[model samples]
Target: MTTTTQYPECCAKDNGDALGMNATATSPISVDGTPVAGELYTIPPRCGRAVKLKKGQVIKIINTPGSQVCDTWFFNSDDLSEFASMEHTRAFIDKIIPQPGDVLVTNQRRAIVTLLTDTSPGVHDTMIAACDLFRYSNMGITEYHDSCADNMRMALNAIGLRAREVPQPLNLWMNTPVNPDYTISWLPTVSAPGDYVEIRAERDCVAVMSACPQDIVPINGCSPKEIQFTVAG
Candidate 1:
C-alpha cells in the first residue's frame, strides 16, 4: 500500500487569486514574452511583467525613480517548478545579498541567472518573503491591497504559465539591513535615479518582476513607482 499525506487547504494549493488589479493580468509585453532586443519595457506601479530570455541573454532592470523596489524571480523555461530560490542562492553565494559576479541558482540548485552589474550601493534583501494578502491582513488592512505575490502569479498567468508555489524572490534595491541584535530595519533605497543592475540568464528562462506595491511601509518610500527593464542578447 502507498501512503498519502494530507495537508491543510492553505498548504495544498497555489491559489490564483488577486485582491485587486493593476492590469498585470491583462497586459503582457508580448504574446510569448519574447521581447525585442534592446527595447525598454515598463512595469507600472503595483503591477508585474514577465519576459522570456534565452541562454546568455541579459536583462537590465532600472530603478527609474530610485525609490521603488522590484521583486524579481526567474524560472527555468523547461520547468516552471525550478524557479530561483533565495535560500539556495544564499547558500550558494554564502551571503544574504548577492553581489556582482554571483550566480543565482534555482530550486534545483542549477544556475539560472548571473549578476553581472550593480550600479547601486548593492544593498538588497533576500531574507524577507514577498508580501501577500496575509501580510497585509496582519498589518490591519481589511480592504484589497496589491501584493508582490499576487503580482507574480498574475504576471505568469498573463504569459500563459503558472507555478506550483511562489518562491522567494531576489528583492532588488530593497534596503533591509540586519542589525547586530539580529533585528532588521526597513529603509528607503539609497540608489540614485536611473541606477540599474544587469543579470545574464544562464539558461532559457522566464523572468518576472513586480514593482512592489508596499505603501504602508517605507521600503518603497511609502509611494510605489514604476520600474523599467530591457532584454539584450
Candidate 2:
C-alpha cells in the first residue's frame, strides 16, 4: 500500500521571510540587462537559498556565467521529507536526462515539477551527489573549502529543515556524459551565459539552490560565480 505523511506548510506567497534570510535585499543580481518577469534572487558562489514556489508558478535557473553549475534540491512544501528523488524520477521517466515536458516525480511517484523549458545545449547529470568535505578531502585538497552539500544544508536550515533531512539533488547545468564503452566523463559544461532551464511546479514545493564552489575542478567555469533566478507566471 502507498503511504503518505502529513507535514507543515512550508511555502507562502510572501517573500519577506521566505527563507528566513533577506536574500532579495542583500544578494547580488547575477542577470545582465533588463530582467525577466517575477521575483529575482542572486545566489552567490558557495552560497545557497530556499525559494517558495506555488503550484503552477514557474521558476527559472539562469547560468549567468558560462559553464557554471547549480545544485538544486526540491521538497514538498507540506512535507520536507518528501523531496525530489532522482533515482525514482529516472525510474519513472525511464530516462536519465530529462527534457522539456518531462515530469520530475517524488519518492511516492507523485509529480512534483515539470520541465517547461531548457535553453542550454549541454547535458545535465542525475547520477552525481553534491560535493562534500569528505569528497574533497579524498581528492587531496584538505585545507578547507566550501561545498554544495554544506550550502544546501544551510539553505534548508533557513526553512526550518535539518541537514540530515536533505536528499540527493538535481544538479543543473552539469555535464556528465556516459560512453558506450561503459565510462563517464566529468567534462566542462557547454552552457553559455544567459542559458537557463525553467521548470513549472506540479505542486507546492520549496527549492534550495547552491551555486557550486568546486574551484578544484572546472565545474564552475574554472572558478565559482553567482547565478540568477526568476519566478514568473
Candidate 3:
C-alpha cells in the first residue's frame, strides 16, 4: 500500500517542508527559544534543537562520543532571512575551517558569531550541504529518512519560527579534509570524547544544531549520536 505523509502546519509554505519526523519537531529548549543561562541541553540522536542567544552570549557544544557530527546554523533572530553563510564566511576568514578567534558571517556579509574556542583539532566542514531526503533517496532509500535539513526546519518550527531556506551549516567535528588537489574525503571525526567548541554571538540570534544522521558515510563514524550544548554570557 502506498502512503502519504502529512507535514506540520508550519510547513505549509513552499520552503518550510520537512520530509521526515524526529523529536526535534516536538521538542524545543524553550517556547521562545530563550535558553537558560548555563543550562545544558541535548539534541538527541537524529534530532535537533533551536536556542536563542543574545549578543555576546556564548554557546558551548560538546561532542560526547567524538564520532558524531553536529550540523549547526545561526540565524538573526530579528530576521530569519539573514543567516550564517559558509560561502561568505570563507571569504571573510580566508579559511575553510574557521578556528578560534575567527568570525562567522551571514549571507549579507554581516558578522553573526565568532569562534571563541575549539578544543578539537579544528577539523570541521564548510563545504558539504546538509543531508536531506533527496540525499537519502539518491542512496536508494525510498523510505523516509531523518535529515539535517529536516531537523533544522523542525527545530525552528518547534520554536514558532521558520526559515525560507536551509543555509549551509557549520558541520562541527565533521572531518572532511580537503586535499591539495582540492578533492575532499569524508572521514570519521578525529576529536576525542568530551571535546567541545564555543562560539559567541555577534548579534541576537537563533542557533539550530542537528546531530547529523548520515550513517551512509563514515563522517559520523557510521553511527550517529546525541550532541550537548549550553549557553552562557
Which has the better lDDT: candidate 1, or candidate 2?
1
List the candidates ranked by lDDT, beginning with the highest.
3, 1, 2
lDDT of 1 by residue, 1-233 (tens): 33323222332455655545669999999987889999999999999999999999999999999999999999999999898899999999999899999999988899999999999999888989999877877777766688998899889888898877778899999999989999989999999999999999999999999999999989999999999999998
- Error at 96, model 3, angstroms: 0.8
**lDDT (0 to 1) per candidate:** 0.90, 0.74, 0.92
The weakest ten consecutive residues by lDDT in model 2 span 14-23
Candidate number achieving the greatest lDDT relative to the actual structure: 3
How many times do residue backbones clash in model 2? 0
1 against 3, candidate with superior lDDT = 3
lDDT of 2 by residue, 150-226 (tens): 67766655555543444778889888788899798777888989999999989988777888888876766568888
Pairs of residues clashing in candidate 2: none
The true-versus-predicted C-alpha distance at residue 157 of model 1, in Å, is 0.4
